[model samples]
Target chain A: MRQSRFGPKVAVAFSLALCWVLPIAAQVETEEWRFRPQLGLWFGPVTPVPGTHLTRILETSLGGGLFFRMNIPSNNLRFETGASYSYYTSPTIARLHSIPVYGALSYILPIHLPLTFQAKGGFGSNFLRNYPEGSRNWLPLGYLGFEASFPAGKVVNIGLRIDYYFVYEQHLRPPPNNPNYRLYNGHFLNFGLMVNFNLNR
Target chain B: MVKLRNILSFGALAVLGCTNELPLSDLLNNTMTLKLLGTYESNDPYGWLNLPVDDVITTSGVASSDPAIGGGSDLVNYVLNASTGLSVRPNDLKFYIDIAEIRIARGQGKAPGQPIPEYWSQFAISRQLLCSDYATAEPGRILQNCADQNGSSKLHEFFNGGFTYPAVDIEHGNYNHLGIYFRRFVTAPAVGFLGNGTFINATAPERTMVATFDNRSVYGMDVASLLQNNYGEAAAEPRMFPLQRKDLKLFVEAGHEPYVLEVRVFVKNNMMVHILQPAGGNAAVTYVAPIDWNTNHAYRDLFNGERQGGSLLMTARTYQPAKSGAIQFSAPATAGEYFGVTEAATMLTTPNMVLPLAATRGTNTRITNLPPGNYNVYRLCDKTRCSNASTPGGCDQAAGQDGYPETVAFCGQYTVSSGTTTNVPLALCSSACP
Candidate 1:
């Protein structure tokens, strides 16, 4: 089944309101409808980690994303979730360029002063142009990060961040050449910034 | 209970998704900078490929005596392969040479990025020599260095290939430095550099070798002191400000006012981001100015002149004549145009880096205005024209030096209301100047 953007189990806020007043309420809902679309970037080095010698990480990266944060009215804490599509490429020793598709998720905690902290994780896959086998590699599995969004305006959010990602393995078997070094497993230590939009507002 | 707990977690996650949702694809697309892959071989010292140039030479190794110098190979890997790439419509390439230094081949045994020893490096810094191990027809192979240097290392210098004007190519730095070269019609600095320099490639702090003294007010002009007195000026302060390269900021040192300082930035993506600052620490200095408004990459062109595998860098000054008997005025814009007398701002109409020539004050310097179009202008004081010039300058290439006499100053474009003549005062070259 195709995944619904809002997920499978969200009770409509109006339904929740009706449930509280209904003689026999069948739906379960608390009460809240909100959307804050924020655009921000993923700040991390391209390589799996800092010390890995074999794989040559291309460059540090940046991208934009949509952030929708729902808050319970009158509460300081907000339920946050988001997803973003980003692109990355690295040239193999054979001059092969591979592009990747990325996705992300997060939970946000907004403070009183234009600053918000978020914990985020995402997944992606690398696709090479012509390499038949080992062409598609899953993005390194685990990512744990924290980001602080600087609210530029009611609609715009600029962010500062620090993130770490872990690599599990390579998608392809080793290439025939000896000089080829693939980045299979490593840790990325990144300090970067981002800009995101508050969609619902 | 475990299954119920998992379901609850899933529900929590979905609820979170409702508000913070963003399309992953567009975010990446917006940040992805365009990169071009081509082999650039030059000895330009800065290995800067973006700034303005008068022309693009077709090939490298222009001659046999030329050194394995220009920008070092490391500079190329840094600017072209290392820095962030620029996102322009179409890309162009050039093999231009403005500075060349001859070096004793350190022996093929040396790998790329390996530093030449510090002591020997200075010998080459102050002087240019053939790879010491290589053979030379000139025997003693002594080369002419820039006139600024004073002592023994003097004979070791390389030739600067003076004034390669009407350069095979040129453009304006109206928007970005290379806009003068590649002609991006935009009127701002390159995008990828917007947030540069904040992060350093921790893997390597900048390499430190014996370069010219790093000063503040004088900028790197002190290298010229190798020619004059040691009245030493204070060091230029290091300022790391925001630029237009998209995601970076670099802290580079600079000089006094009136000199817009653009720095040559190299990233992993091989993009050229030029960061600018007004000549001095004038807090009021805010907007970026156009033309050689840079201070850092002065010696970059030297890398492209050598046989080294690095990118080349040339300052905005190459296309600009210095204050002299012939020309004492600065180019109208701080970011000088490419040899084509090109400006980054002018790219809006025609997307070409065609160079424009200069018109002097005296003599019926007639030029048939081609194509009935509006063109940004410039002027020259061809010293070779003055009869009183030291060599009675009349195209006596072997006997004459450069610049027009101060008496015959030439200026242009007094903002001529289009379809009109713009006469600028011209300076003639002086016999004392050289």
Candidate 2:
């Protein structure tokens, strides 16, 4: 991950570019409501528990959590935060799974059916189990993802997101069945499609 | 020599022009040119030129004087049979077995910038190698010999003749099992009920004669550990050398010079891959003897046969890649638990495939009748039965294969899409977008 020391610049550049191009989504006329539930997809790389065998194996990662965006009444910028539930299968960790809790800060890129990509990073944990001896694990995760939205009612919105996460942790697990050996580690990669009930647009 | 060199170079050169020619055949013949995506052999079109890094002999390598080829006792009157050291009821093998059915797919990994494809294809089949060398010289299993009564002529029907399932709901079918051929590891196999006579019913029973070898031969756990530690595990690509996780000249031996190795693999519509390390002692590569299907009235020996490794290695990477990274493991859990980082292995640990073996002509081994072309290779690992073949064995694709490690492993693909001198490095996998 040290190699990515320079990634922040490029990421920030792209984020800025999106920020300049998109205007804050016009406040949905849920005239009375102040909350917008967003349907979204969370994308990111997952770090299996250190010594996680399926850390790099191909995985089936699918997860989604609710997205809540609080509107800053006076400005175009809004505060966006959401917790996602993801289910992804690592090629090595064939059947077992990893779940993460994520929090994101977004710059609402504007358009009517607006599209926004969050430069979201958060802290989370992977509860790896079905193991002979269960172990507890959690790690810090950073995500650079994009979200696309389409038509919905005044306040309620539909969202789709693709996220790529950099799960910070070593990947390499001992053969779960026979812990005497080592297995591969597959990073967490997820594509989430969700329907959020927009409380505030 | 100079003239020959020029021909080789020119033969390799790609001509970039469209010309209106005489006849179509003549144009086609003149255009026997090719466009390849990988390295091609300048000397033999049938062989591939490796990515050599200077052939400066480092230490004048020591040759294995272990009879590199041809020298084994002629155990001609070979009665091929398999048996569990003890009579195992079908139920017993069930307790000791796990199965998987594989379906093959392909595609460019979904990355930031990759070609948006117009069409994609998926194949539902099992990846297992069934060495057809069941017949050598006379008095062999007539069925294994190409000339015998049940030889080559019968090969077609038996060789990947395309299996038929009793139901598409095969997800829960009995045919999904460790069948007569050990290579086919099916999911949810129905064992223990063989022709109404179960092994538990027998006073004292033994599965097959193969089981006798483990009892009779010198069991070597060190060898198994050495291989497991070194080779890691076998992915579906058998053309790979279990040692370096790359393709090196490899073969199975019977005796000094009398080596009969399985050099061919048959792909079938059956969606399962069974990697039985074979139930033998040396616990070595079991391409030595042909599988004995009739031993226990049930073609597939439940006790012996193939034992694969546990865990499957999928080709996906997300470790912030640097120009170069260390292959070592992380820290250890505690005492009694050995763990450390891995050194950079020969194979690339990246997700994109680096090598592929599409034909049986020349697999893993350096010598074979293969037409020259550009080829791609990669390092891949799949789930094998754990602790069921070797002292601590497990290698059944039916079981889940492990994930990729930090080591350098890769696969390749062919680019014969070019002109005449075809470059077809088939970097293939069991599934794509995985």
Model 2, A22-80: lDDT tens digits are 44333334334254344433444333334443443224444555556655542344556
Q: Candidate 1: misplaced stretches above 4 Å?
A: A1-48, A54-105, A109-113, A122-140, A170-183, A186-192, B1-434
- Per-residue CA lDDT of model 1 for B361-434, tens digit only, reads 22223222212233343332222211111121121221221111211211222232224443433232212221
What is the lDDT, from 0 to 100, of the residue B173 in candidate 1? Answer: 23
Q: Chain A vs. true chain A, TM-score per candidate?
A: 0.50, 0.54
What are the lDDT figures for the candidates, one per model? 0.26, 0.27
What does candidate 2's lDDT look like per residue over B104-138, in tens digits? 11322223454322111111122222122232123
DockQ of candidate 1, scored on C-alphas against the true complex (2 decimals)? 0.03
lDDT for B409 (candidate 1):
17
lDDT at B273, model 1: 25
